[model samples]
Target: MRLKNCHNFKDFRKLAESRLPGPIFNYIDGGADDEVTYRNNTSCFDKCDLIPNVLRGVESVDMSVTVMGQKLDLPVYCSPTALQRLFHHKGERAVAAASEKYGTMFGVSSLGTVAMEEIREKHKNPQVFQFYFHKDRGLNRAMLERAKAAGVEVLMLTVDSITGGNRERDLRTGFSIPMQLTLGGMMQFAMKPMWGINYVTHEKFRLPQLESHVDMSGGATSIGRYFTEMLDPTMNWDDVAELAEFWDGEFCLKGIMSGADAKLAADAGCTGVILSNHGGRQLDGSSTAFNQLTEVVEAAGDRLDVMMDGGVQRGTQVLKALSLGAKAVGLGRYYLFPLAAAGQAGVERALGQMRAEIERDMKLMGVTSLDQLTRSNLRFR
Candidate 1:
């Protein structure tokens, strides 16, 4: 299928699969070993049914939400993922522009292809810098300073990825930073010549965020190695507290899945805590964010914003999370697939569709504003 024919997440995913190379597409599609949690993230939504109210005059809808400290036109924002340029030549630039047009927050990954400074200079919308705590404290502090200098509105520390997950797809495809693809993988890339052409014709791929400190050249460092060797496995509440103090702004902890941990984040001065499992990219069989939303929200919702990511494909899913008490939701592969399919335009199309879905679903549910949604609107099956 083509971008024009894509109307939903699955359609965009199909187009992306057809256009992108196997390794690249799988990078965005695949989760941890077995992918049980990855599949369950969306499946859990099926357990609960929305009880819509009729005969209400719903002429207009307001989907705006303020999470962390930024006001978002939509309840959903783009969560940061690594190596966007590999998925599409436009990379973070495409995602950033689309988020700006949609008036939502866009996260810049520590492994993002575009520089935070450049994106900050280009986009006027709220931006978040998603990074990890490194073994080198000095490096972590410096990166925080850099983000502060760039005027990033949020600092999201990904606490779950102390180490990389067992992504068997990458192992099978032999996918790495420098790309030591197996013979079969090489054939897959060769099959998609258009992707290769665009990849080669564009500027050389580089992780601008880590290029200054990490030597990623000539396969000297792989992402797996970076996580295993560089990231601090000993990161604790103390470390997070220190970082939050240094950030001293809209700070949040991504990858938080437990109520107690969410409370700790609130006590540590976090402005928000994202109920995420790294999009099921880490820890197979872990609880989906949707499944853990209520616990996290109850524990810290009054203290700080409780947001969630993973398995958010439909607008109804966004509403369900909001009704359950999530201040906002995050999109990962939802927009990435569209980006891979048609670059910037594809992303905008996906965002526009999502906006429409939320608006229409809101009116149908007899709610004009997000505040009207409550736990009473849901019935668990």
Candidate 2:
């Protein structure tokens, strides 16, 4: 399938699968062991049905929302993922430009291929720097300072990934940072020569965010090693509080899945809490973000913005999360597949389709603004 034929998340995923090598595609598609939560994240939305009203005279619909001090024209923002350049040569640059066009927030991962400073200089939109708390306190402090200097609008510390998940697909394919593809994986890449040509023709692949501190040369550093060796497994609320205090801006905790943790984040001076399961990449049986949204929102929605990401593929899914009191929703694989399919243009198409879907669904729901959506309009099955 070509980009022109892609219409929705599934379509973009198909296109990406066809365009990308198996190992790379599986890296984006696979989840933790058993993959139960991965499938449930999107399916859980079906448990509750949207009860829409009619004759409300919906002429204009506003999808704008303010989460963690950033005013997003749309209710969905791009959650950061690692190593974009491997998927497509445009990398974060393409994602950043598309986000600017749509007037939404974009996040740059600590493992992102593009430099955060360069993305900040190039884009005039709200940007988030998603980083991990390192064992070395000095390294963490320096990364925060760098993001602050780059004028990053949000600081999202991923709290769930103290250790890497058991991604069996990567293990089977032998996929790593400097890809040690198995023989079968090598054959898959050979079939996709176009991807290889583009990958080599573009700027050399480097994790600009961690290159200064981590030595990833000669295939020495795998992501698993990065988590095991560099990241602090003992990170707690106190450490997060210290980081939030230092940043002293829009601070958010990205992997919070419990109401108790949500309350702690609010007390710890976090401006926002994202109820995420690392896209089901870290935990196999953890509750999907949608199922856990109401509890977290009720726990700390008043004190801090409660947002969610994972299994958000359709406009109705976004609306369902918003109706439950999410400040905003996050798009991960929803946009990444399109980026891998056709680079910047593919991303633009996906975002544009999502925007159109949201606006149309808003009118159908008989609401001109997001505030009109609440539990009153929902019924659980």
Candidate 3:
């Protein structure tokens, strides 16, 4: 199927599966052990019901929202993931242009294939730098400085991934950086000949974000090693607080789950907290972001901008999050699969479908503006 046929997350996912090698596709699609949290991330929305009101004239809907000092025309923004160029030749470039067109924020992972400076120079919309704390303090500071120099709007430090999760899929498939494949994985690659041809024909994949800081060339750094040996498992609130103060910019923590942690983030001067479970990639069986929204938002909603990511697929889900006081929501596979399937066009189509869904749902809910949504509109069952 092509980009035009892609109507929802699953449609784009199928297209992406057809286009990418099995090992590469699973790297993005699969999650932690048993994939429990991963599955719940999107399915949690099914537990709630949308209470819509009719007969209200929403002639034109205003979906614009401002979060962490950046204005976005839509309530959802792209969540950063690694190894983009491996999925599509355009990679982050495709997502960047689509986010720009939609006037939404787009995050670039610390392990992204594209360079932050290049992405910054190319895209005018808000850009977020998704960072990981390294054991080397100097490297951590240098990364912050580089992102600051690039004029990135938000510095989002991922707190949950001090060490990589137990992703059995990667182990079974033998997926690693620089395209190391097991015998079984090699056969899967051979089966998808078109993906192999496109991958070979396009420019070689490189993690420009970590290329200079880490020796990824010559097979020096594997993703597993990067997590096991390089990341600072000892990272604490104090270190994050100092970084927040140093950046003196729009700072956000991307993996806060509990009310206590959310309060700490607010106390530490974080402008925002993304209630996520790393898209169920980092932690298994952790509570879904949507399920914890009310508690986290109640604890820190006044002091910090509360946003969430996991399991957001439909526009009504986004509206539910907003009605409960989420500043915005994030999209991971929602856009990534589309990017992998048909590059910018696929992403735009996904965003277009989302926009229409949000608009139609908003009017049906009898709201003309985003702020009109309130807790009174929701009732948990």
lDDT of every predicted structure (CA atoms):
0.92, 0.92, 0.89
User: Which number leads on lDDT?
Assistant: 2
Per-candidate TM equals 0.98, 0.98, 0.97
Residue 316's C-alpha lDDT in candidate 3? 94
lDDT of 2 by residue, 24-73 (tens): 99999999998999999999999999999999999999999988888899
Off by over 4 Å in 1: 219-225
Predictions: Cα RMSD each: 1.1, 1.1, 1.4
Model 3, range 235-343, lDDT digits (tens) per residue? 9989988899998999999999999999999888798999999889888999999999889989995799999998778999999999888999999989989998999
lDDT of 1 by residue, 257-293 (tens): 9999988998898999999988888999999998888
**Candidate 3 colliding pairs:** 41-311
